[model samples]
Target: MSSPTTPVRRRCTLVAPGSDERKIAKALESAADEVVLDLEDAVTSARKDEARALVCRTIRELRTGRSISVRVNGLGTEWARDDLRTVGALDGVGIVLPKVDTADDLITADRLLAELGSTARLQALVETPQGVRSIDEICSATGRLEAVVIGYADLGAALGRVGGYTAERWLHVQDRILIAARAAGIQAIDGPHLSILDDAGFRAAAQWTRDLGFDGKWVIHPGQIDATTEIFTPTSAAVEHARRVLDAMAEAETTGAGAAQLDGHMLDEAVAVAARRVLAQTGG
Candidate 1:
């Protein structure tokens, strides 16, 4: 019998890189499109150096599947510089940046990363009132900026409240962030759910985010990954319908098919495109 081979890339897209070596490695195997080995908020001030070293080595040693990212501390901090210096020296460090506030913040960080001889793609955090205020500038900062993660907890903090989903309000802000990212042609990963115990809230939030046109969301707890994966995965029924729509239309040699009957149920081009995207994501 032949040994099973590793996939060139895996299915998960919610970025969840756990703290510490063992759990982080476990997550890498579990299926996150990318795992950010967080060195900023997740790592306390005292353990910054330890996390830095661990991440740098993990870059060299982790199995190939999901992309590896490290969220270094903000600029102007001692640890931030060392963290950048260390991770920047290693290969396969995909993205590293501080919590961005303004265009200046992103521009300065992009330059610092370049100065460190890093070609890592950048991901900015749209977390503060200031950050959201300057969304256009931050989104337009540099072509190297590949993603903008909407930082819900931080945004809630800046709003002077302990945060949880208030659908009417937060959803509006999230839409703005998502639109900005889409306008810039960058991926949007909604911030992680801080509420570990409230799985109901987490799942609902994840589903709402997926509907909001976000490419993905951040995952803090491993428990959150299941909801992330479930909500985000394109369903089998949808996939089959998409296949039928495209196949039937191809045979008819027409386009822009709308809410018309297909196998006795209504189908539309809009729904068909969505299904096709799922197939593309699954490499079907």
Candidate 2:
């Protein structure tokens, strides 16, 4: 298969530690496909209101910037009401409901969006024991639910599971979440790597997520974007190989051949489909 040279949006986004709202716009442009203005673990209880207010302000005032998402207060938080009501009012804001464990959470949020006349989409942070159990039902909750993000930090804590470096423990959880998201035709974003200073560790984690079939990952720093792009985007050689396979298949079709071969490997319908899809997506 031949590879293309054009650049596309990588499958990662960097989020500020809290909804600082100061450098978010620039951070989004700095190299991420999405920028989450966090109001959950990033914000302290004392500054929840401040974070929420800043997130809402950024949504409304900074409309001309890159993709902006919000990780809102959990279902148990005192600020959930105001947080939902405020951010739901903004147009094009992607809402990330944290620690979701039921369809009712999404239904309630969707109702709020309708009442507010907002067309925003919703993403679930399936981070609870019950959330993992109810994964299928949660995926079907609302038309607004467009993605599922695995919040490993809170999830492990909730499930009484100890943390690890390779995420081997969360493999089952991650696989199940991916299955649910794909069934719903939604994107699946993996959780972040906690080690902030280790670029190699972050890159390995990013590659791990990509290999797990996640469309993207939760990034915490600016340095991680290049790594994310490196993992998500197909290399020039890969793009070129896809192009060659596509062309060869086209030629085979013109000659009324049953199939084709690329690099002495038999090419079939499945391979053709994948190659064509990649080429079209990357504009090869």
Candidate 3:
């Protein structure tokens, strides 16, 4: 297992088409914790080369302190090799590999990044059934694997489901991915909500995922960023409560007690661990 570390606070990752400079510029200016310049799904076959050039140039010129990850074309595609060779060489940019089915995919991407002398981390998207089944190996594939994002839409299609986000169909899949990510000490990011116009629906889904221990979520639009960020971030009251929990725990330790009562609730090591996580996420 990878050594545990304070998790990076990436509450919202906004996806922009690589071919759309206007959207990319707006994403850079937005409050997203990360911006993904997408070369797959968002770009057409005829424009793949153009999108790659735009993404490389944008990463080179942009000054956003937030993470800038480029989602390259999937493996086996004609453009995948060139995408990795070119965009992977740029400094200050991470690679988000889509349709990763095994550890070998991650290892190959890591090797390419190394050969190019880039220090960017990897974010693997587990979209297919094979990817989901081999998530554990993928998470442990390389030390440079920083995050695993579930591609819900593709996964759903692969599973023959359509149209709606059904919790019954995805709960186990999400949990399995989350467990693999946590075991490997990496981030587990929830996929985008396609109902961008349904604020309530998005909020409900975001809250559900957050409650299930997902570290962050993807934002398909700028309007979705604020809500996703708000949902993932610890509230001020929660942070204060976490602080008090730690203080009480410290007092208990000083008294040579293994546990203590915080307000009316019994507090112990598990609770302390959770409280610490809350504070760490909020930078409290």
lDDT of every model, 2 decimals: 0.69, 0.76, 0.87
Off by over 4 Å in 3: 1-7, 247-269
Poorest lDDT segment (10 consecutive residues) of candidate 1: 1-10
Please give the ranking of all candidate structures by lDDT, highest first, separated by commas. 3, 2, 1
Residue 73 CA displacement from its true place in model 2, Å: 1.2
Deviating ranges (above 4 Å) for candidate 2 = 1-10, 23-26, 240-284
Clashing pairs in 1: none
lDDT by residue (72-143, candidate 2, tens digit) is: 887677888788888877766677899898999888888877888887778888888999999998888887
Clash count of each predicted structure: 0, 13, 0
Candidate 2 weakest ten by summed lDDT: 1-10
If candidate 1 were superposed on the true structure by all CA atoms, what would the RMSD be? 6.5
- lDDT tens per residue, model 1, 8-85: 122234444334787677767765666777888777778888878887777678757457777888886887677766
Name the top lDDT candidate.
3
TM-score-best of 1 and 2? 2
Give TM per candidate.
0.78, 0.82, 0.90
| Candidate with best TM-score | 3
